[model samples]
Structures are given as C-alpha cells and as structure tokens.
Target chain A: MIAGIPISKNSYQALVLSVLGIALVLIMLLSLSLGAYAIPFSSVLAILGEQFGLSLEGVDRSAANVLLQIRLPRIIITLLIGGGLGIAGAALQGLFRNPLVEPGLIGVSSGSALFAVVFIVLVPGLVSGSLIQNLGMPLFAFLGGLTHVWAVYQLARTQGRTDTATLILAGVAINALAGALIGLTLFFADDSALRSFTFWSLGDLGASSWGKFPVAIALIGIPSIMLMLEYRNLNALSLGEREAFHMGISVQRVKIKTLILSALIVGVGVSLAGMIGFVGLVVPHLIRIGFGANHRLVLPASFLLGAILLNVADLMARTVVSPAELPIGVLTALIGAPFFIYLIFKLNKINS
Target chain B: MLQAEDIHFCIRQRPIVKKASISVNPGEILAVLGPNGAGKSTLFKILAGEISCTRGQVDYNGQNLKALKTHQLASVRAVMPQHSTVSFPFTAREVVELGLPKDSKRNSERNIREVMELTKVVHLEDRLYQQLSGGEKQRVQLARVLIQIWEKKPFPRYLLLDEPTSSLDISQQHIVLDILKKLKSQNIGVLIVLHDLNLAAHYADRIAIVKDGLIAGFGKVEEVYSETLLSEVFDHPIRLVRDQETQQILVSSNSKFHSDLKISKQAQA
Candidate 1:
C-alpha cells in the first residue's frame, strides 16, 4: 500500500539507510558501554578516539585495556559475524525466493560445526598449539562448510540447474548426516574434550582477540560485501530463474556465486563465533518487513541490523548471568525460533 | 525481425518442438495456437533465448540470438511466461520497474509510468503484486515485459508472451490485445500464444497452428484458418464462420451433440 507514496524510491532508500546506519552506530556504542566492569561512556569514546591520536586526559588504563584490548575486539568479531550472517541470509532468501529460508538452511553451519567437533575431540592436541588453535580450526571449519554446500548444490542440480526445493531438501539431508557425525564425535570424547565440545557448540566468543579479527574479516567480511553487491541479480531472481534469464541476468552464474559466497560467509562466521544462530534469519526478515522487498535495500539493511542485533545479544550474554556468560548460540536460538514462527503466521495472514 | 530457424527441442528422447520454423516481422502480431501439448511455449522459449534450440538457431535483426550476450539480446527481446508468482510482497510498480534496463536508470521513472499506463495497470501500481487478481497480475507482467523492450534503438524489438490472456475476462482480454496492437503500430513485433481462435482472428496479423511439435499451418489468418487445417491441428471439429456486419472470421466448435440435437428435433417434428 505504501508503494503509492509520493516519496521518490531513491530518496526513500537513502532515508532508510541513513536512519538504520545511525541506529546501528548508537546500538554499537551502547553495547560497548554496557558490560561487567563497565567502562564509562567517556572512556569508551576516548579509548576509541585515542587510537586515532586524540589524546584525552583522565582515561583509566584498566578501562582502556578492557575496552580497547578485550571488549572492542570481541565486539568487532561479533559485529562482523552478525553482519556476515545477515547479508548471507538475505541473499539466500532472495535467490531461493522463500522468506523462511536462511543461510544455515543450506547446511553450512552444521557442516562447519561437525568439522570443529572433529578437531576438538579427535585431534585435541592439535588445537592446543596457538597457531592451530587460532588459525587451523577456522580454516578447517571454512573448508568443511564450503564442501557441504558444494555437495548440496551438486545434489540439488538437475541438468545444470538448481531448484530451490531440491536445494533445501539436500540441505536437510546433509544436516542430518553432519549431526550424526557430530554425535559420534561427542560419544568418543574424553572429559576435557567433552567440556570443550559443549562450549564450542554453544558458541563461545571469549576467545576473541585482535589476532583473529583479520582472518574473520578476510574470510567473512569480504564475501559478505560481495553478496551485498549482488543486489540487482538477486532482485531479478525473485521473479524466478526463467524470468531472471529473460531479464538478461545469467541465472546459473548468479546461483553459483550466491551459493559459494553464502557458504564462505556462514562458514567463516561459524568458525569464528562457534555456530551462532538466529541473527541471519531474524535480521533480514525484520528488514524486509520494515522496508520493501527490494534486495538493494534489504541486503545492506540486513548487514546493519544484524550487527546491531548480535552486539546487543552479545552484551546480554556477558551481563545476564554475570561472570558466567551464557552461550550466545543458545540465546540466539531461543530468541530466533519464536520470531521465526511469528513471521510464518504473519506471512500467512497477509497472504490470506 | 525475430526468426526461429528449424528449431528442434527435445527432452531426453521426446521431441517437444521439432524442426519448427516461425518468424515475426516488425509491425505485426503473430499468434501461435494449438492443443495443450502443441509445444507453443517451447517455441517461444527458443525464440526468446530462454533455452537453446537442440538443432537450430534463432536470429534477431540478422544476429544469432545464442551468440549475443544476454544483456544485449535482452535489449531487443522481452518474454513473459504463462505464470509468474512472486512469493514476497512487491508492489506492482516495483515489479514493472524490474523490467527497466540497468543503464536506463535516468529515464526509469518515466518509462515505468508509461508502460503501466500502456498496459492499463497504472491503477494497480500501488497494490502488492501478490495481492492482485489474476488478470491484474497478468497485466502487470505485461507491463514489465513492455518496459524491457520499450526503448527505441536502431534495430527492431520483439515481445513474446505465452498465453497472456488465459486468466482475463472478455474486456480485459481485449484491453491486452489492443495494447499489443498498439505496440505493433510502433514497429515492434509481437509473438503470442493464444488459446482463443476468435481472438487470434480479431487481432493477429499472422497465425501459426502447431501440432505435435511441428508447424501445421503458418501464414496470414485467411490462409491458415481453413476449416480442415484448424480441425486437424486441434483434433476438434471446428467451423469458421464470418460475421455478417464486420466480415470478421469466428471459429465455432462443431460438437457432435449440436448436429444430433438438430436431427432429433427434425425427426420428432
């Protein structure tokens, strides 16, 4: 109904992006200020500015270390992972043309989780070294995620064309198999390995350091930006593959690009954050509901909102239980599942 | 300006369109009519470059359709499938705007409005595409395709539509056909698959009746709409009648019951 509004489409898009960007920055700053041993707002600002040579007196050293060294890196990782999942989810939904579809619906996270479990339980000693612990786990997890998505894509393809239903079904089967493999790994784990597996599966962001940020950015952030750039092709695809082809879009190339980009993003996010859930699904859905279904708007909006949502969620994870952080994944699923159900009902109502 | 030369498309071992050749000249409406499995849609796909012909080639303005880059080919040809269902809620205007070329953003607003007006879907532009009636959706889709090839260039353009009026009421069907007629006047070729022979007789400049993956009859309406040719192609008894006032040809079904009932009444009397 708002389609007939007098506002120009370009202006409306610019307005929405501007407002969302401002809100995201505000939420991010609030997140930086709301943790245990909370840094004062001034110190948070000063520490952020000090890095750019803005010397402000009265900055506490401990607060600076906590904000700059500890919290900032963790928050940055959370933002990147959240944004990555969000854009990936939006792209996948547009490609599939199913509002209910998410990045994880293609078995990327489960496959990566399976590999991470294998690393923890099967070769526990390999993860103890700093180099392997930091770099190796994420690399192997990315490869695992990429492999599963490729496998699913291959299965879903018939005569070089991928069907949405077939892809989703293949994802379901791959997830079940990966889950079984993970369970088997769990069964063979020793006590220490068992604890670590449980921690990793629940998504521990406590290992966040400046050292891991570059790898996460290189793996997830760049691919996510690439997905966002596919706004036009994704929008065309919403009409169906044949329509897209007729619209001058290379439908097959778009499909393959989106699939690989989503896998890389979700793969990297899972490896870095340990299988966080719901941000990808919920953020993009909410963006579509608020704005129109234009992918040009939806994809970037998803990134901003996804970052805000996870930063806020991570803030909650650190503060709610105090000193004992709840697994971010558990919180996300608890929040995401009900929201997803509500979205389904809303869609049905609108359709009816 | 659009020609499909000896197009043969097969699925595994079954031929869908075999050695079928059809062409549409600029400033003409060519209607393809046939039975359910007559392969009209497959031929349209080959002409629009949606699928490759298994044994032949399509040419637009003397250029091979397959060899042209997709975007380049799209500038000259636009296709509307039989049914296009968008799951998400896109406004009708947004759907129409999707047809605009990437480089024509500066003129997009004007083009979108003009096409919507041309298709008689300007009123429905504000409504969600998913919420529109079947006829309205078809019109919106038509507008979308029209916008795609609306730009004037050195070469001719083609519009290919598949069963566009299948869901429309009588007046809506005329509105669509009239729009195509107007487009034809602009020197844009139109290729349409129609189920109604009468509508084809009214609007089409040429008629091609397809039967079992082959062109059974192809020529001007007068040459192609003979009683035997149509009846044989559709596998139904059909009679071609002309209107007394306008001299328009109309097709009527020669059902067995019509003659049987007449004979029974005569016998009783």
Candidate 2:
C-alpha cells in the first residue's frame, strides 16, 4: 500500500527513499523542538543558524543549551542506533533466506547484554567515569556478541553448509543460557548499579552525549557499510545456497561475513542503546512489504524508516509523560505491534 | 569443455557417486539418465562445482576447478537447479536479473527480454516469483540461468541443469529442450540430468546412463539406448520404438515390475 502509485519500480523506490530521508531530517528537527523546555521550532533553527553567523532576535540563551547540549546528541545517537538495527535485520534476513529472522534471533543482543551486566556487576570500579562508560563496557559487550555468534555458527555448520534451522536452535540455546547468566550476575550488583542498569536496559537515548557519539558512529557505521556491500551476494543467496554457489558465490564465505558484520552492528547497537526491540524486526518487514524484496531497495529503505520510526517514538517517549520518560523498548513494541498487525491484514486483503 | 574424472562423492563413508567420469564439450547436449537413487543429481552437482568429490578432480577447459574462484567460474558456467526458492517477494524479472554476471559486457535489458521470450516467460516477468506455478517457476528459473550465458564469449561456456522440465507439460517440455538445443549454436555446452527417457532420447545429442554411482552406458543416443543396456541399467524391461518416417528413437517402460506391489511380492515369495 505504501507504493500503491502506478509507476516503474526504480522510480517508485527512489520516491520512497527520498521521502524517508526527508522525513528523518524533519523528525529530527521536530524532536529537538518538542521536549520539557519546549524550544520553539524557529528558535531551534535560529540557534542552528547562529553557528554560521546568521543570528536572529528572541532566541533565548538558556534554550540553546537545552537544544545543543542536550537534544542534538540524543537525536543523532537515536538515528545511528535505529538505522544500524534496521539494516542489520535486513541483511541477516537476506543471508538466512528467511523473512522471520532478526538480529536477536541470532543471539547478538542477549549475548552482548549478558557481558554488559557482568562488566557492571563484577568490576564496579570501571563504572565511575568516561573510561568505562565510553569504551570498556561497550567493548566487552561487542566481544561477547562476537563469541556467541562464532559459537552459534559452529553449532549450525555440518560438513561445509550452515543449516539455518540449526543456527536458530543454537541461538535459542545461547540466548537462554546468556539470559540465566545475566540474572545470576545481577544478584551481586549494588543498589546504584542495579538502578542505573535498569534504566539503561530499557533502551535510553537520553544517555547519548558528544563524547559517546564518535565511538557509536564508528562501531555501527563500519559494519553497516560492510553489510550493504554484500547486497549482490545476499540477493543470489535467497534463491537457495546451491543456487547461489552455481552463480559463482562462495556461499560459506558470504554466510560467515554476513553473520559477523550483522552481529557487529547489532552488538554495538545493543551495548550503546540497551534493548531496543521491534525496530530491527518491524522496520525491515515494513520495507519489504512496501517495496519489493530487492535488497538494493530494502536495505536503504529500512535504514531510513528505522531512523524515522525511532526518532518519532523517542520524541513521544519524552513528551507523552513529560518529566517521567517511558522506556523506548516498551513503547516501540506497544506502538509498532499494532501497526505491524494492520499491515499484515492489508497484505492478506490484497492476497485474498 | 567441462570434465570430471573418477568422481567419488561420499557421505559418512557411503559413496553417493563413485568413479563416475564424464566430459561435455562445447556445442553439444549431454543428458544424464538414470532411475531414482542412481546418483545422477550427485554427479551433476560434482560437475557444476557445487560440492567437491571426495576422490576426483573437475576441470573447466583444462583449468583446475579447485583453483578457480567464484567470479571466474561464474562467467564460464550457469546452473538451473532442481528446486530453487526465493525467500522474499522478488518479481520474476528481478530474479532473472540476479543472474547477470557482474562483468557482462552485453546489454542486460536485451539479454533478459530475449531469454524470457525464448523460455516463453516474459508475461510473468513482473509477477512475484514465489506466486508462480511449478511450471512457470521452472521456466523463470531457466530464463535466469540462460541469461547468464546468453552473450557470445571468445571462450567456451557451459550450462548445467537438474531435471529442468520435470514440472512442465508436454508442449512446455519441448519448448524448454528447444531452448537448450539452440544453446548449441552459441558455443555453450549443456549437461542435464533427465528422468524422462523419451525426452532424453529426443533432445539429447549424447547420453550417459548411470546406475549404482557408475556409468553403465555412455555414447551417442543411438549407441546407448540399446534394449539390454537400458533394461539392465533401469532394472526393468523397456521397449524402444523408432519412428519409421523420422528415424528417431522413442522409449516405453510400463512392465511387470511396476504392477501391483502385492502381486510382485507374492510371485517373489
């Protein structure tokens, strides 16, 4: 229904991508303007314009601190996390040749989340300042994700082929084991660490700052570029592994690279933003339904749509309850689940 | 030319294809014929480089298969597998375009249209590939493979297919084989595993009859479609009828072995 206009697929996809890009920019500006302090949209623009020597009248000085010091980093980090999660889902689904697959289905989130819990619990000294917050915790989480993915791939492989069914089963086992391990680690945590951990675990973009943005960008950005480079191989792979092999793809090599890169991006996102569910799973599915299932179109569209969806959701998260912020992970599911169900109904109506 | 020598493929030490040697030259069609569990598909896989044989080497135009990378080998050969499922809702045209080799110098548009027309699947080009019927999907896949080797090359090329016409009706079967027949003019060799004896007899320029993971008969259709050779290879009585006007061989294989299972068991008892 999103692409209901009668047009060529290339032009239609272009129109959709452009719309999503514009919407992302608009939603970011909107998010900056609407919060507890309520900076006006024109003043938000003037404050941004003042940096380039185009100052305007009545742009309050205090509002500039709230806009630049507080909201901008949050918006930028929110976009990065959402975009990374979306493309990770798209690439993982393509590599597995299944629409149901997401980054969590492969155990990256739980694995990374477990290590984060352990890092916070066991070494309370590291949690005090920028050293632990910026690099140590996220790095530990990234390595944990990498280890679990390697284990899952090993369990799924038979001879040379990685059976997708076995991969999912292994992921489920690792998730359960990791979940239990995280719970065990939590019992040792002090009150301060436990409270901080709870707030972070619920997926907060409010934690984003200028200092953390650079690392998040590098961690999520590199893997996204790598994953996007594999569009051709992933396209061929969906036709079946042997089919891809016959077309000159090194199936095992592509499979491993795709899995690792997706894990890298998803691992970074989970460690950076906590457990933001629904965006990875729902965003890619929405794109595939709106646009045809070409990875060339699906990947970019998912990235943009994901950024837009999460930015808008986060804006609502901060504003809807005013001083009491809602957990983004909970809100994404609450809002996105109903929309996903509606799309499924629309698809069935067309099919019938 | 595509060549595999003494190919032995095993699983858990149980040989699926053993000591099966065959070669397909440019400008010819080689139909691999056998009953179920005869390892025809396994041999086809070995030849296409989908799986490495446990005890043999495959070569493309005298170049070692193991030494070749995916991109290098892909330009030389394309394969249409027995079953291929696209996970997403890609249109038939998009699926076919997936076969366009990255380094192809030809016009992809003309190549796609020409291949789809030859396979008679142009009408279904915009339809979702997963929504197609069995026969339509087969033809679309055939179009996908054909587009890969459609352009003329200075070097030899090969196309391998596994039971490409199993789902097609009689007329569509002829259409499919006729497309392969025309590939001979483009200097592309085709090796197909065929289950239908009559279709193989009519379309294949040469034949390789495999039984028990070994070649039971190999030569021209006239040389290999013998009464004793086919009957023993298939483990059943079969009759070969020749068209008097055209001098073409036809096969019929409805005999006592295919009768009621209880009657055959009683007789054996």
Candidate 3:
C-alpha cells in the first residue's frame, strides 16, 4: 500500500496551481507594462501598490492614469472572461464526457453572435452612449445565448435521459439556424456597419472598460466560482452519467447546472469581448496533457492557462503592428490553430 | 433488504423487462443468471434505480426507490453497470476515488488504497484509466462501486453488479466474486447479474434464472439449479456434475437444444 498517495496528488496539483498563479501575475504585469504606451514594470507595480496605500515614489500622473484607468480594468476583465471560458470549456466537456466539446459546440457563441448582428443591423441611427445601445445589444445577445442552450438541451433530452450524440446534433441544428439568421441580418447592414460587424466578429478584449467591470464580475466571476466548486461532481460525471447517478450525483441536475453555467460565462463573455475562440477548447486539453484529467486540477488549471494565453495573445495583438491593433480573435486562431495541429501530430505519434 | 416487485419496463411500447419480481436480502448473494438479451441488464438497471420501471416499485429498506433521492440511495447501496468508460484521462486511482461521497470527510486515501488492494488494482493506481486492460478496468470499476459501500454502517446496504466477471480471466473472476462473498459478512446484500452458471452456482447463496423477460426460477441453489431447468432457461441440453466429496454443483451444457431451433436463439434486441 502506498502511504500518502492522495497527498502526493494533492501536492502535485497544488504545485501546478502555484506555478500557474505566479505565471499569471508575471504575465499580467508584462501585459500591463508593455502596451502602445510602454510603462516600466516597476512603475506599474508601484501604481498598483499605491492603490493599497503602499508608498511608492516617482509615479507619473498620466502613466498612472493610463495604467490604472485603462490597462488595469482591461486586464481584470480579460482574466475574468478568459478564466470563465476555460473553466466553462472544462466543465462542459466533463458534463458531456467528451474532451473536444467546447462553448462553441452547443450554439452559445453562434446564438449570441446572431443576436449581436441583428442588433447591429436592425437598430438604425446608432447611439454610442445612449441607454438603449449601451444595454440593449448585450442583453439581447445574452438572452439569445441562454435561449439556444435551453432549446438544445430540450432537444437532446428524451425519456428523462440526455443523450450525448443527440446533444451534438441539436447543437448542429441550432448553429445552422443561427448561421442562417446572421446571414439574413447581414443583408441589411450598411458598409460602415458591415466593417464594424467584421471587427466585432473577430473579437477585441479592449471593449471592456472600468464602466463594465462590475457587471462582468457579476456575470462571469460568479459562474466560474460555481464551476470551480463542481470539481468533484465533474470528476464523477466523467465516469459516464449512469455511473455518476449511481455514485450519488444528481446526473441530470448537474448536467443542466453545468450547461447553464457555461452558457452564462460564454454569453456574457461574448457580450464583453466579441467571439474569442480556441482558448476555451484547447486550454483544457493542454492542462489535461500536462497534468492528469482530474477536474479539481483541470478546471482551475484551464482557467489560469486560459487567462495567460489570452493576456499574452492580447499583448501581441496590441503591439505587433504598433498602434494598429489586430483583432484578438484572429491572433488566437493563428496561435491556437498551429499548436492544435502540432498536438494532433504529437498524440498520433504517441499512440503509434 | 432491496426489493423490486413486478417491475415491467418497455421501450417504444415493446417490453424489455416484464413483470419480474426479485429481492436481495442482507447477508447473502443473489445471482441473476440469464442468456444475453434476457432483460438481465435492464432488470439490474431498474433495481439500481438508473431507470424507473413502467410498472411496480423498488423499495430499499422499506423506502420507495422513487421517493428516495439518488444521494440518499447512494449512502445505502452501490452499483456497477455492465459497461463503463471514462471520457477524460483520469488516473485509475482518481477514477476509484470518485466513489467517495463528496461530503465524506473520513480517511479517504486509506479507504481508496484498501479498496484498490482488495480489488488487486494497487499497481495500476498511477496508470491512466484508458490504458488499462479490459479485466483491469473491470476490477477498477468494481473497486469504485465497492468503495461506496465499503465502510460499515448500522443499516443494511446492497451492492448491484452486472456482468462484472465478463472481462476477467478465471482467476480474476474468482477474485472478484470472493470480494463480493466477503460483503455478506458486512451485512451487505449483493445482487449480481452473471453469465457463467458454474460461477453463480458456486458463490451465489440464491439464484434467479431469467428467460424471455421473466424469471423462470428463484430460490436456494439446490432448489433452483436443476439440470432440466438450467437446460430449459438456457435453451440447450445441459447436465449437472457433482464433486464426490465437496457435493458442489457444476453445470455443464453441450450439443444443441432438445427442442427445435427458435427465433429466441437469434439476436434478441
């Protein structure tokens, strides 16, 4: 018998979390300090320290204002949304018992995107800071995302059992429907509206400001925490739903909670930062490969790695062209696509 | 006691498990022996509360199965299904650890280790579950369910398993059944669905022979394991061999059915 085997596993996961946590801090600093206007890393720290009543001298006003007001909220929002997507992906994958299942597969992204496009095309004489434009589009898109999940969930459930194959098929149907709707709305969009739609579709983390921070916390932060608390449930679920039910998990209820939580995360994320992909789908796989597939480890690690990936990608996106920021959506795919191909080859070789 | 009365299940108006009654008592093993597609698994599923029967009810310790919540039932019983697979790359040890109730705060590591040792899967702890052999995987899954009800409680508990020995070799099969037999001392009743008649005859305290969606016989081994009944339930010519000293019942089947071939011999379901 192995003494302290579980302890060793716990320590290993703790070590992984610590490393990811430290790396996230470093990446957050680097992302903050090195943007279109480069501030010194120490100054960025000092500016942040000043908030906590720590006395640090030689703080420039504009630099502090830019760092505190512009960069910090964006960073915080990115972390929340990115972490939300990662954990959501991991949870949804465990819920469905498929590693490949992502936030995109169940029509959350497409449904939200469809609603966003319709809002853009339909609401004429756009007002930037008006009450309707400020809240209307996001609310519409969020509802759209949630409604699609309900539709897909009902379609997949038969005889009180959620069939896995049918869930994916239902996703396909909803996605196709949403795709057609998006195409239909595109017909009414003017040239300028079309350009903005293309940009929004490509995704931008910069859309979030200090104004949106509180709502982002309410929408994404709470759901991510709930997902994190579901590690044990997710672990049991990966054994297959029938086994989970026998092992004391309310399988149907867990599935619904997981899907709804995932929808909330992705829905609000799509609202805040337009359709950023790949991090949700691939970050969990990377964590599983590096560490084992225990949800206790997978969900948190996916969250950290997701935040890191997005921050780094956002860093490059804003800096690569210098003042002309590339869409984070384009960069994530560019970064994520090649690495995914490489992973496929690596796994194939390992299997052979 | 775990009791199911007149349980009938139907799929699309076609009967699967029809009007079958069975009970598992504390301190004994009840083996459900049947040919493939004889509704053995479906019956197991119904008793395990994985699915609600179309008719009749299951009661565990006098509590209606439908009235009891899943977690409530879980504290009193554990189930090992016929087929199970993990989707992610969880370690075998991790998979086994899932059996521990989320709210359980006991020495779980020791519990998992002890159960792994009991199931003879101690060496496969660190190995990825997907990499284990079929027999190894079966044992691991058995350990998972066993861990659920391993710690003794005041009330009687039940263990329901379906075809646990199907993937195991002769020695491994005996090991698994021996573990189940040991549960009787813990006041835990075990209801196992098995294919091998001799194994059931050897270890089962009581036997239920299922054929064509109904139980052909249910009683003590001596009253149930007759040569004629075994042959009829299995639909093949059969004989029973007895060890001279041990008086053990060994079932043997060879040659075709005494009756003419029927459609039941073909694939059911």
Candidate 4:
C-alpha cells in the first residue's frame, strides 16, 4: 500500500494568508497615523489600546478623539470597501468562469452610481438635510443595482441555459445606458450638487461614520464569508456548468446566489465609497496566479490583499496632495490600468 | 443493479432518446455503440441522472433515482462528459481532488495520489491541467471521476464514461479498459459509450447498438454485431470473420471477401 505524499499547497496558502492579514492590520494602523494633524505612532497605539481597555495614561484627548472618531472610521471603511470589492470580484470571476469578469462588468457599480446620482440631483432636499435624513441614496442605489443585474440575468437566459457572451453583452449595454442617464442628470445639477456628485462618483471615504459601519458589515462581510464557504462549488463551476452539475452542484442556483452576493457587496461598497474600480478586477487575478485557483485560499487572500491595497491607495490619495485629497478612484485607475494591461499581455502570451 | 426503464428524452421539441431501456448488473461492463446523432450521450446522461427522462424512470437498487438529491446520486455514480475545458489553471491534483466526497474515511490527499497513479497521471499531478495535452487532460479527468466513486467499503459504484479514451492512444485505451475490468471484478458497474466498435466488442459484457435515437439491437456481442444489423444501422455492409484458433469475431468490410463468401455459398447450395 502506498502512503500519501505530503502536500504543501494548502499549508503554503495558509501561511500567505496569515502574512497578508498581519500586513493589512499594520497598514490600517499606519493609514490612521498619517494626516494633516499627524498623530504620533505612539499616540495612535495608545488610543487604540484605550479603546480596547488598555488604560494608557497621558494620551492627548483631542488627538485621541481625532484618531478614534474621524480617522478610525474612515480607515475601517476603506478596509471594508476594499475587502468587499476584492471578494466580490473574485466571486464574480468564479461564477462567470471568466477572469475578465468583475463586479462593475456586470453593471452593478454603474447601476448603483446612476441611482445615486439621481438621488443627489432630483432629490437634493432629502440628501442636503442631514446625515440621518439622507438614507435614500444608499437605499436607492442598492435597489437599482439589484434590479439591473436581475434584468440582465433574465435577458441572458434562453431555453434553460445562460449564454455567457449574451450576459456580458447585455451588461455592457445596460452599463452604457446607465452612463448616459448619469451624464444627463449631471448636466442639469447645480454647482454644489455637481461637486458632491463628482466626488462621490470618483469614490471617497469622507462619509465614513460609525453609524453606517454596521450596515456595511452586515451587507458585505456576511455575504463575502458565505461566498467563501461555497468554494468547492466554485471550483467545480470553473470546469463548466454541466460538469459542476455532474459533481452534485446545483449550478443554476449557485450562479444566482453568487451573482446576488457579489451585487450586494458591490452595491453596498459603491453606495458607501462611490464607484471604486480596479480592486475587484485586479486583486483576484493576482491572488489566483500567486496561490493557485482554489477558492478556499483565493477568496480570503483576495479579501485581505484587496483591503490592504485599497487602504494603501486611500493613504496615497489623502497624503499625495495633503489637505486637498485626490479621489481614491483616480489613484486606483492610475495604478491599476497599467497592471491590467500587463496582465492581458501575459495572458495572451500564455494562451499562444 | 442499475436500470433505465423505457427512458425517453427530447431537446427543443426534437426527440433525442426514444424510449431506450437498458440495464447493467453489478459486475458487468455495458458498452453503448452508436453513430453520430444516435443518442449515446443522452442515454448516459439519463442513466447518470444528470438529466431527467421525459418518460419512464431510472431505478438503482429498488430506489427511484429521481427521488435522490444530486449529491446523493453523485456519491454512488461518477460521470465524465466529453470536452472538459477549464478557463483557469487548476492544478492536476486539485482537479482530481474535486471528485472525492468530503466525508471519506481515508485521507483525501492519499486517495487522490492513488487514483492518479492508477490512471498513470501521477507525473502530471503538479502541472496545470490547462497546460497539459488533450490525452493527459483526459487521463486526469478519468482519475478525478474514479476518485469520486472510490469508497473504502464495498458499495455498488457506477461509472458512466462518454468517449473517455478517444484522445488516448491504443496502449492507454487498453490500460483504461483494464481499469474498468478490475472495477468490474470488484462488483462495480461500468457503462461506457464508444465510437470504436472493436474496443467495445473486446471489453463489453454486452453491447447496445443505437440508431436514430432508438436501440437497433442490444445483447451479447455475438448477437448484436451481426452483418445484417450493422449494415442496416450504419447504412454500410460489414463482414464478420472469426479467428480459426481463438474463435473471436473480427468485423471488416472487404468486397472480395464478400464475393468469395457468395461463391462458396453457391457451391455449398
């Protein structure tokens, strides 16, 4: 009888994930420490410790408040949006069985952005009132995102099978239509509203607050974990739909649930931070190439790596021209586009 | 132990399987032989419960197959379809490991290695499945499905293979057939669809010849491979010759041999 050969792949993946998790935590703290009123690293640590019942003395109360109240929420939101986008992208890629597929490719981000612009332009009174009074934008954005994807799915289904090319084409068409409507709405907006809409669409973490963290966590975190748990099914699906069904997966049901989960995460992230791009498209592919295509590893690693990348990008956005703050979306595209192009070239070479 | 009773199937208002019925005992190897568009794959799909039959039912061990959940059916049978493609570069071992049930007693890594060795794919274990040649991919896929149904305790496992050896060379074909024979000796039922009638004749306990979505003839090899049936089903004359020493049948198409047989028949009459 032959004994089992030692397998290092799973262990290697676990180690990589552990290292990334630690790095992400450190980056999150580092992001919290750098700003116009730069808090000392010691002061940031003291404030964090105090929050966790460490009882550190001589920490400046105002600095503590700034770190705890303002910077902490923004940093947390950055991580949430980043991690959410990454996992959502990975899940979408796996569900669609195409590396080029991303959350935005399915029209979720554009659909959400269009509805968000509509809320800001046509219903300014509701948004301009107060933070508490402006709940309609996120709600409408989520609803619009879900509705558009459902419509695309329906349009793509024919004779009990969903053709991937048709689905992607329909998503592209919907995204174009949504873009046109957004442009029309923007053209009619007042100056202040235009600025807000532009900043929102370009993606920012300015609206981060403790009040909204629970909603983000509930919407993004739970679904991301659930998608990760379905890793085996996703692996089977990568082989193709019929093969997955033969392996006992309900392929149609998995596809629908995966799409919904991805849309929910993308919708919530966009509603909070406003249409951040490239993290979803790039992070998952990078992780798959680095750690192999097992979702059990790829999903979590993508989430952590995404959070770290976005947090670092957010840090760059804030400090590059300090006190003015470039949009986070701009930083991502500036960095991500070249890398995406390089990946396409690499993929083509491999295929050839 | 596996039975498809009067199964019928259609796609888009066109019948693909026309009331086809077949059964395989626990230790038998059943081969389905057909031309293009003869519903061999459709029959395999129905037998594996991958698709529902439009009429009739499939029963395994007195239990209705339709009543079982997809996972439940998967635990008992493994099906490998033609044209397995991957968009991502899943490693060969990882692809094979996907077939093993999560709750198996033996270590999954051990089972994966064993199956790969059985299918002679151990050398390709670390390579990406997509980078391999067509024959290598087929072998890896075969190992995957084999690992899927390889239980420690004896259970009636069934393998439904659709042209599994087409990409393989002659040596690998015999190796695959040898594996199926070993499985049959262990009371595993094997149902394979083949375009090569010679391979089917050599390996199958029974041959089912299908034409136009229905069975033209199905029985022991000698009964099903008659020249008259082959001519009618394939729309071409076939000559069946026997080895003088081994008495095994060989199918051929030689006009001169047919003419000589006609002359000999005239002389005997």
Deviation in Å, model 1, residue A1 alpha carbon: 8.4
Q: After superposition, how far is residue A283 of candidate 2 from its true place, in Å?
A: 0.5
In model 3, which regions exceed 4 Å deviation?
A: A1-7, A124-127, A130-135, A153-173, A342-352, B256-269
Model 1 lDDT on a 0 to 1 scale: 0.85
Model 1 Cα lDDT, one tens digit per residue, B1-269? 88888999999889999999899999999999999988988888789887798998899998998789988888888998989988677889889988888888677778888888888899887778988888899899999888988877777899899999998899999998999999976679999999999999999999999999999999999999988888888888887666657878878785755575456446646
> Measured by C-alpha RMSD in angstroms, how accurate is candidate 1?
3.3
Global fold similarity of model 3 (TM-score): 0.92
A1-352, model 3: which lDDT tens digit per residue? Answer: 1335555767888889999999999999998899899999889989999999998899999999999888998998999888888988888888777665677778888888888888878876443645576567777777788789889879988876568789989999999999898988898789877876877788977766877777678878888888999998899988888888899998878877887788888887887778888788889998998888889989889989988988888889889998889999899888777876776697678569
Model 1 segments beyond 4 Å from truth? Answer: A1-5, A121-132, A157-167, A188-191, A348-352, B254-269
Q: For residue A157, give model 1's deviation from the true position in Å.
A: 4.4
* TM-score of predicted structure 1, chain A: 0.92
What is the overall TM-score of model 1 with all chains considered together? 0.94
Where does candidate 4 clash, by residue pair? none
Cα lDDT tens digits for candidate 2, A147-210: 8878887898786666878988998999899989988888878887797789778887787888
Q: Model 1, residue B252: displacement in angstroms? A: 0.6
Residue pairs clashing, model 2: none
Q: What is the interface RMSD of each candidate, in Å?
A: 0.9, 0.8, 0.7, 1.0
User: What TM-scores do the predictions have?
Assistant: 0.94, 0.93, 0.92, 0.93
lDDT of 3 by residue, B1-269 (tens): 89989999998999998889999999999999988889998898889888889999999999999999889999988999878988888789888988997666677878888889988999998889989998899989988998898776899999998888987799889988998888788899999999999999999999998988898999999999887888888888887666546778766675443232233223221
Instruction: Please provide, for model 2 over B32-73, each residue's C-alpha lDDT reduced to its tens digit, 9 standing for 90 to 100.
Output: 999899998889878887778899899999998989998788
User: Where does candidate 4 stray beyond 4 Å?
Assistant: A1-10, A125-136, A157-162, A187-192, B153-155, B243-247, B253-269
* Model 3 per-residue lDDT at B155: 94
Error of 3 at B107 (Å): 3.0
